[model samples]
Target: MLTTTTSKINIQVRRFTIFDIENLYTYLTHLSPETKKRFGPHKFDKQSIFDFYRESDKNIGYITLDNENHSIIGYFIIKRGFLAHDRERLEGYRLTLDNQTDCTFAPSLADHWQGSGVGKLVFQFILSDLKKMKFSRIILWGGVQSDNTRAVNYYINLGFKTLGQFSHNGNNLDMIYSIDQSTGKTDGGFDQ
Candidate 1:
């Protein structure tokens, strides 16, 4: 299991292992609609999610934030150094280099935790782990429906910049964002 320091709230961030895949599956399957649209169609059942750990080239890490009751209040996944081709929305922005690394996030929490600073804590943990993994840069592409102002603002606040807008379905266009880890800046005003 991976362990991370928590804030004064006493939330602990720990890495998920093969044994924890089932729990992770449960978490992912029940995420909010906004999160599902951004990172879903996970394309795997419980066994497949577990099998991924056996692959030598993949780096999968999950951090679960537990509350005083020992119940998981939040979680995040980080896949190191690979271009995710399954996400059709990112077709134009896909990384060309084999060495490029990208990150995606899915947070599962009740509405109460939305702006309680839980995301910042989880993100900071992911960033620290990425640095230790020796990745020079990381990109996170989030799709926001034009009307989803809350999500667009959330990603921007987290330091992701909008590269441009692209249509996902015939009716909704997604705002693409990119972040440069080297400078910790985004193309849009998200970094500020």
Candidate 2:
């Protein structure tokens, strides 16, 4: 578990549990249309969310909550392996995919907390955890919309590299991040 404070409120991040279903559902249900459009790896409906948890044996969900009210402020999914679509797209770009060392990452923050620095804190903890788990790289799940400047900049600021681009509803860019296990730091020029 990771804990920190932002805007004077204590926040905690940990793996999702059965107890978090309702709270998580509330959070997902309340996401704005823009957010939903940017993050559509899975359905946000109650049943779809529940089905994802039940059927996703290789995916892990992490939730960030506020200590004051225990409301979910962020949610992230770390997939153990790439999906067929992602693999195909990556292969077309000549980028190698290693199931043992590469995983898919997707993170979303509450609309209210979008630019409050909460996302960076949660991401740092995840980077460290992934390194410790022996993962050497991470790919952005479903890639990111080329026009989502904020997200594109955020990923670049976090050491992700643009491996290639593809069209998905609109133009999308596939990004990859290499984890330097030796120093527990991300290896890439995006941050430089």
Q: Which has the greatest TM-score? A: 2
- Give every collision pair in model 1: 2-15
Worst 10 residues of 2 by lDDT: 183-192
Model 2 clash count equals 0
The candidate scoring highest on lDDT is 2
Q: Which regions of candidate 1 deviate over 4 angstroms?
A: 1-8, 29-35, 41-45, 55-57, 84-111, 141-146, 170-192
Tell me each candidate's TM-score.
Answer: 0.67, 0.91
Q: How many backbone clashes does candidate 1 have?
A: 1
Q: What is the lDDT of residue 122 in candidate 1?
A: 63
TM value for model 1: 0.67
lDDT minimum window of 10 residues, candidate 1: 183-192
